[model samples]
Target: MPEVWERGADDEFAGRADDGSYDATARVVDARGVDDEQRVEAALRPKRLADFPGQPRVRDQLSLVLEAARRRDAVPDHILLSGPPGLGKTTLAMIVAAELERPIRVTSGPAIQHAGDLAAILSSLAEGEVLFLDEIHRMARPAEEMLYLAMEDFRVDVIVGKGPGATAIPLELPPFTVVGATTRAGLLPAPLRDRFGFTGHLDFYSSDDLAAILVRSARLLGVEALDDGIAEIAGRSRGTPRIANRLLRRVRDWSQVHGRGVVDLEAAHEALALFDVDVRGLDRLDRGVLELLCTRFGGGPVGLSTLAVAVGEEPDTVETVAEPYLVREGFMVRTPRGRAATALAWQHLGLTAPMDAPGAGAPQLPLDGEGRFS
Candidate 1:
């Protein structure tokens, strides 16, 4: 479970700090910390384009841009990678760093809440460094505005002091490249999106691509995966490389515990079953979230807040983490009113959809892969 912090929940939000505690900014910076688990994940992250798997379209397009930029000995154009989490946005960011032959300075939108915070980071970047800003749409508007000018002109106007004496300090930044990543592209302002020279949407991987990923992971972890086992995992990976890798990791644990030398069908099935991840790619959390919305919420015209309470998940996790897969899998719909479980969702859960299920007076949104959606 993620820790709960009260940064925005008190009088500390008031600048006076009458409680005898430090200011928010100081506490904020001091509180930002990561642990060994995250460190291991980062170290294990694929560092180059070739090392990264899935999203063939993005990989091919990015390769062309990289080759062209490499020839000119210049910084590559600003790029935006929009996709679901754990689908290799960060991996792609690292790949951009490696391909451009430059260092990467990683940060998140909420991490730099103020313009000065962004200014300090941006001005300090070396030329050609890849500044990967993840969840960029969540950035504060003021900093985002500053980002526009910095991106367009490689400069920023640092404002100092109060109304009468305020002055815009002109600061030049290095011609570094910005690799903005977001799971929700709709939330990004047009001006911000338009500044990027290239935008890549990382779609879900095909089963074949996921199979290749399993092969790669097998090699990396020194496990011999049977062909059938790989195929099974691939089909049940939620069409995401991250899930594929995670399933592989879990299977590895199974092999070790059971004294198996290779990851065969039995080992794979046992491991996946233990994790409650079904062959159709539905995890317990995914199923529970859908079940609650469909049954408990009555095919939902239910508000997200109410649904989140029913399912015990962060709303963002439902929206970004789980729903994309559910939505893509023809399991749900996001309507103007609220989220609704589709006919396919009912079928998957071994139940029947409501009378209004798709085309039967069901309200359908303009979503991708709509045919099987209901």
Candidate 2:
């Protein structure tokens, strides 16, 4: 866990002390900094689909869908965007609204606790408006049911009263579009999933694409970044654009304070190092999991909960946040027994894999021609 810095009235930020230097306690390397990103992400977001980078297939498909709707002079089909966090799912939703030249109403699944809450929002939506529901998988069951009828039939049944006296007043709604974004698409009910006319899955971006995103972000933020500095941050961003932008800001801070107000390769390295991010984009928690697996467990299969306990983290955090990247990068494997470190993990940690270690002589899986196991 990252250290906590107590905030003072005089402190410029919770993560900074009265002095100019960073407290070194903030979680600067986390990809899921939703609260922090919200403050600056709006300005950095691409307003239109044409301005967005990466996800070529999704971009093209979305463009065609929007253009077709425009030619028809009607609302576009409901769009479902599925992907890991921080890969521009929300941005794409906003872009859909922008491209259609319509107003957008943004809400998340957790915010809609009741069917009535969803009913109110749906009834008030103007024709052609886009409703962007984020984290759609976590929506309450009743609200999810309510959304189903609204999406398909453009109507909602608003219940009025209680018990047998309750009456579901059929409410006709204006034709509109729903752009739903979910990090875990599978959790969405099949009926709700099927309601979407277009589904787009976003993949992790390539280094070149991430570099392009960084260049654009630097220009927007007015940060003078060298080519190598941008490349360095992009390489260590774990294939996520949000992480890349956050690291760029930290490197910019480091440049302003220590260097000559310019983001260069050295500034990027120093900033990332101070934030506890390694060259391979592994932060403290990530390295902790690998170190414990290789050093303590003898590279044997270990239960997820056991690993999480040893790392002082929740099991869900270990599984969702750390495990995906570790497994995807070939540093770990999920065996029938449990989680086990691979030979790559040992090599990355500068240790040798024992002959009895799990995955020591295991057959390597074939890559899908994308540097990922098929």
Give the TM-score of each candidate: 0.80, 0.87
The global C-alpha lDDT for each of the candidates, from Candidate 1 onward, is: 0.83, 0.90
Q: Which ten residues in a row have the lowest lDDT in candidate 1?
A: 24-33
Candidate 2 error regions (>4 Å): 1-39, 358-374
- TM-score, predicted candidate 1 vs. hidden true structure: 0.80
lDDT of 1 by residue, 257-295 (tens): 984767888888998999999878888878998889778
The global Cα lDDT (0 to 1) of model 2 is 0.90
Error of 2 at 209 (Å): 0.4
Per TM-score, the best of the predicted structures is 2
| Candidate 2, backbone clash total | 0
